[model samples]
Target: MKEFHDIAWYVKALSKELPNDIRNPAPQRLLGGLAYIIVIVACIVAMNKFDINLVEKLMFSLVLGFSFASMGLLGHEILHGTVVRTPWLRNLLGGIAFAPLSVSSRLWIKWHNTTHHAHTQDEEKDPDAWISLEQLVKSPKIVRWVYRLPLGFRAFVSFVSLSFTFSMHTMRMFFMYINEFKSKKLVVWLEMLIPWAVWFGLLFYVGFNKWVFMYVIPLLIGNFIVMAYISTNHRLNPLVPINDPLANSLSVTVPKFIDVLNFNFSYHVEHHMFPGINPKHYPLIKAKILEHWPERYFHMSLVKALITLWKTPRVYYKETEFLDPRENTAYDSLGNGLDINNIKFKKLKSV
Candidate 1:
């Protein structure tokens, strides 16, 4: 990884400038959005027009599912400003990308961009932190069992349960808004209700069961794929200290096949470090960064990672250090300290 330390030297010595074309992100956003629309339309047409057997339905479902997953990945890029030049443009595209999936853009922005990014692997503040093997060892037996299950399966279930998941968040935000009168809370309601209304309205007014089946089912499946991809990429890794983004995030050296399937989200660490760079530019940035710090990077194929996680034995935790709400930590938000003690629960109870 010493090579990564030499990045500044290389940049200074080579003094090479990247192409202006590489900086133009609008085209990628347009292309990505178009790809999503085409795939969705194709799936709808197939379901509605063709007299398909179970085998065909299964195959088409997988194809459409993977396509929807890729769409979500592209939508993530837009949210990070990787696919567009303007925030408004990215927001517009992001809204479209999440509409079918029934996710809240506002909630995603808060959880992913704000909380997760700021805290990274901070067990106290980062909701996405890796619960350590030692911590797992001390956990209750049930906690150990749940953590031991294949993360992919857990992710699949979570994806299928998105409607319930976001609905709860929506309700929480609704009450919070009512209590606090914060305008930001209103954005949450708008984000959730508008998509729900549109989807339900279509089902009610159009009377097209095929559209519901084609678009919504595939959308949920795609959401599952995205969740699986994310869990495999990061959750099982050893927890790094909150301050260290490099150690906390994983960077898999995926083959071209997987990269194409995932929209190149495999380079997660590089993505975290240079979030401003678009998804299309991740490969370029990763190559440049790898030239500097190879050892710091971790690469595993998706299949290999999944298999290893499945084969691993359960490790549970009982008690881990968390930011005390009374303490002065960097995680304090708006005079409110992060209350890690509140996180002491056996399992994430299903909503």
Candidate 2:
């Protein structure tokens, strides 16, 4: 077997064989981003103008929701320098793309681009990383029962939290890192309030009932669309101290239609490999990785990743062992976790 090294070593090797334009921004994708925004706008306008029933309203809301989430990934990409090189233009367009969720582009850069990416799956460091058994013990009892347990009541409906949890986590991270943004607090607050003002203004314009369908319900759907990818992105992978994209990131295959809608964000391992690269080129990156490091790179279907996540305990006892403290049972963190009887309870050495 080849010796493992940091992600940079792999990137350097991959670049030699891949096309030179792989890292270049796809500005044309910005038109697609604008189209997504138009979808959100059209949905809201039609909801207010037409005498649509609840069923019709909901159908429109679903479309709006997907557009909101889809634009979100475009914002995520632009923030990563995927499309625009000019910092001002990048942040401007990125902020617009993220406006539906009222997420601040600047804060996203600090929270997601800087911290989360820097510490992909470090238990102590990655804020989005799942809890450890020791930490789970410290949490409240109700949380232990109701939160994302691999095989309990949580398994049934905790998935819905994805609808709003991504934005909630984003807001929480802002206050959580208040100290770091203290100097630039004004810009941060201004950016946050600007998008929120437009949204809230629409709430009054549309009135409460219409606003629910227009903004609130659609945002929830949007959150669900975005969080589906987020939940499957790194949470299923084993936590690692060393930053190894191949070992720590799992890229799942979605149908081509879904992939196109989300800007190929499913090529998550590729995104981690080159955060600054255009995702339009992600398929090529995937080919190179599979060609050179098939043994180390992890790939699975999106459905399987979601199923494995639903069945596995969220708290890790060891790097590879997931523990549900109530039963003192250890399930394989990276494997199918459906059958409790098949679970091996011993703690394996962190590999």
Candidate 3:
């Protein structure tokens, strides 16, 4: 693991190896962005213009939801200024891209770029990191059951929690942050308000049920898709305080189509190691990483990675272990089952 102890020097060396022209490839960005937007617009138009049956309508809504989630990913790139050079244009594009999700780009940048990126695996600082199982100590019997399910069942539970619940909670977080009275909070306010106002106005113009099918369900599904992909980003990594991208982030090997749809987001480690680099170029970065540090570079296929996270409890019992709250036991970071009585977690400095 000391291979990454000198993370800074390694990163500098990798930067030197990248071509001088290394930048976000405009074709990938433009093609992907436009395709997602076209999907959303086409879904809306089909729903409005055609006399489609219920099954067709349902299918269209699902596609629309997937499109909105894709747009959210694009918004992420825009906020990073990878979509275009001009800051104002990037912000404007971000507003439209994230509008369906109702997420404020300014708020997301402040939280994700500043907080999550800076403190990736730090238990105290990365808001996206695992929380304590103690938070569930007083939960109801049903809640405890949901928390303790095996991999297959837990995956289903995650879909429900993420899709139905987390989306609204995220918007509330945006509102709460807006109340902080920062100077740029107004930009976030407008970003949050404008699209929502337009959506609601359109919803009222259309009937209630149409609104529900067209926008609300899609929003839920889109947010759920985002969460599903995001959960595997760093969830399986050891609960360490250090910021070494190699040790704390994971690259999930997925189909090429998924990479295109997600804007190559499965290259999580590459993205974390070089956040400024366009995701389209991650394959180049991946080649460099393997060439330079073949023994240190790690990746898991998408299915296995998701299953591991599903089976493994999310709360950290130690910096290097996960707690299975149901059994009151600890497992190593790699998800190996171990007996609680035999484990001594005090060796962890990060704890």
Top-TM-score structure, candidate number: 2
lDDT of 2: 0.81
Q: What digit string (tens of lDDT, one per residue) describes model 3 on residues 1-351?
A: 433443476678798899887765353486777888888878887787778888887888899888888888888877777767677777787777888888777887777787788898787688677665554555677876776766346656765777855467567568656776388878888888888898898787877867877898888888878876788788777755468887788888888998888888789888888877788888999999999877666588877776666556677665666766545666566323322224332223232
List clashing residue pairs in candidate 2.
none
lDDT of 1 by residue, 10-111 (tens): 344322544456545645456756876788778756776788876777667777767767766776777876676576666777777777665566666666
Total clashing pairs for each candidate: 14, 0, 0
Candidate 2, 1-351: lDDT as tens digits: 124467788888887888777777789999988788777778888989989999998999889898899989889998998899899898899999998888888889988999888888888888888888767767898876654444665655768788888889888987887568877888888888998899899988989999998889999999988888898888767777687788778899999999999999999999888888899998989998988888777778888877777776677766766776655666765433323234344544432
**Looking at model 3, which ten-residue stretch has the lowest summed lDDT?**
338-347
Rank order (by TM-score, best first): 2, 3, 1
**Candidates' TM-scores?**
0.70, 0.92, 0.86
TM-score of predicted model 2?
A: 0.92
Q: Please tell me which predicted candidate would have the highest lDDT against the true structure.
A: 2
- Name the regions of candidate 1 deviating beyond 4 angstroms: 1-26, 130-181, 205-212, 313-351
Question: Which window of ten consecutive residues has the lowest lDDT sum in model 1?
Answer: 326-335
Which sections of candidate 3 miss by over 4 Å?
1-7, 24-28, 133-156, 179-181, 334-351
RMSD (CA, angstroms), candidate 3: 4.6
